[model samples]
Target chain A: MDNLKIEGTKQTPEIDFNSSTGILSISGRSIPENTFEFFNPVLLWLDEFSSIAPEKVIAKINLEYFNTSSSKYILEILKRLRIILKDGKDILVEWYYEEDDEEMMETGEDYEDVSGLPFEIISIDDE
Target chain B: MAKQSIYQSEIENLEESKNFLKKSDYSKLELQMEFKKLVENYEELIDQVKIITKISDRLQKKLNKTNIALEDSNIKLADLNDQLNETIDQLTEAKIGRKAATIVMIVAIALFIVSEAFIEPIIDNMFPNNFLVGLGLKLVVAILIKPGEDFTNKYMLKKARKEQLRESQLSHNNKP
Candidate 1:
């Protein structure tokens, strides 16, 4: 499987998925103009990755901000992770938020509850 | 949506499901098992969609805030830039006035020196002991001092105003 790497922008986040390392990371703000178009490819790649089924898949999501459409896509990403979880694979979702960002922390909790997946809600120092 | 449009999609979904009842012959027990399984899958999909919609909405709000902050910063930056340009223009005007004053003072001093050294001696010889010509020449420059400064000030101000007006007009036209 080829590694997936996407650069971050003012309106979008960065995506760095390493096939060899089994560590997928998405960080930065995500407020793309068209959420569906931006995330469709990323979802497809994850689907392909799930088939190969890496020994341990770790997904780290650290987002400062994201728009409504981007939020929907994020849920889709977590849903994909749930599928991998069903395949008897070890899946870890580490959700990082700013220390002072209570809203982001709450948002993470919502995802954790709904996905029914083990999610680690971590806080980092504010920038 | 209109009444017909609301039923359109639901009717389509039911029609597709009806195909199973039309062509397939199944035992009563088999039909019950299949219906239960179909309901289970649909319930799961609906739950997943619900979660996705909730989370996605929150993220979108955050994104909108970031955009608002960026716009506010841009407005502040434009205001500061306008203030800086105004100060620079005032400073330029002050500098021009200082230079004009220095030039005028230098010319007045040179005239006084020439009148005292050479013109006074020649005039005294011609008029036979008259110091009035020397006094008159000094008075002319002294009288002209204020007018000379006024001319310089008026000229510099006109030039500055012309340039400033063009800049202000250009900026106003571009203002959002």
Candidate 2:
């Protein structure tokens, strides 16, 4: 599968999914005009990647902020990863938040609870 | 073409139902099927509402937290700005004070020169060597120095304030 790379914008996150390395990263804000349109292709890609996924899949998610609709799509993305896990694939979610952002840390915990995925909630200094 | 919107399918479903009701006969079986579809749609709608509401409320909390942080930062920024303005004012006063003193000193020197070159000769003609009179004239000039410096300081300060206001206005207008 071709690598999926999307540049970040003021209102959207960056996506860098390398099939070879089995490392998918999303960073920056996610408040797109159309939540479904923005995430549909990502869901399709995950669906395709599931069948031929590498030995280990690491999803690095470092979002500064995201709207409600984007939050739903985030859930959808995690649910897809959950499916991959059910198929005996090794998958992990690395959720990063700023050191001072308690809400973001709690949000990562919430996603971990809802998605039933192994998550590493990491904190880093704010830019 | 842009991707189909998330709501498109839901909207089309509603439209189809509306058209069916308008054109089709009121048969029992058809009505039952239509009602079933509507009920299913309603259930899905309710599920979506639940999810959206939960997420919206959570996000609202996050927004409130962010707003509080922003307001705190703004307050700190305003405090810093006030301190900066005070420092600028102090520096401006010091600079204007020096300028005013320099101007007053130059004027005093010119007055002294004029008195010595031209006015002292006339005084000598009238009084035949009145040392006290010359001393008094020089003293009068010396006395005026303080007031001259005061006037210069006030004028320069007013001009500086006007320039500051103009620059502020220009910046405000230029802001995007």
Choose the strongest candidate by lDDT: 2
- The TM-score obtained for chain B by all candidates, in the order given, is 0.60, 0.74
As a TM-score, model 2 comes out at: 0.79
Model 2's DockQ score = 0.27
lDDT tens digits, residue span B29-122, model 1: 8788768866765676577567657766665666677689999999999999989988987888898788778777887788788878988888
Q: What is each candidate's fraction of native interface contacts (fnat)? A: 0.35, 0.23
Candidate 2's residue-wise lDDT over A2-120, tens digit each?
Answer: 98898999999999999889999999999999788688888778888888888899999999889987886787688788888999989999999999888788888878876789999
What's chain A's TM-score in each predicted model? 0.96, 0.97
Give each prediction's DockQ, rounded to 2 decimals: 0.27, 0.27
Task: Give lDDT: candidate 1, residue A125.
Answer: 96
Candidate 2, residue B113: lDDT = 100
Q: List the residue pairs that clash in candidate 2.
A: none
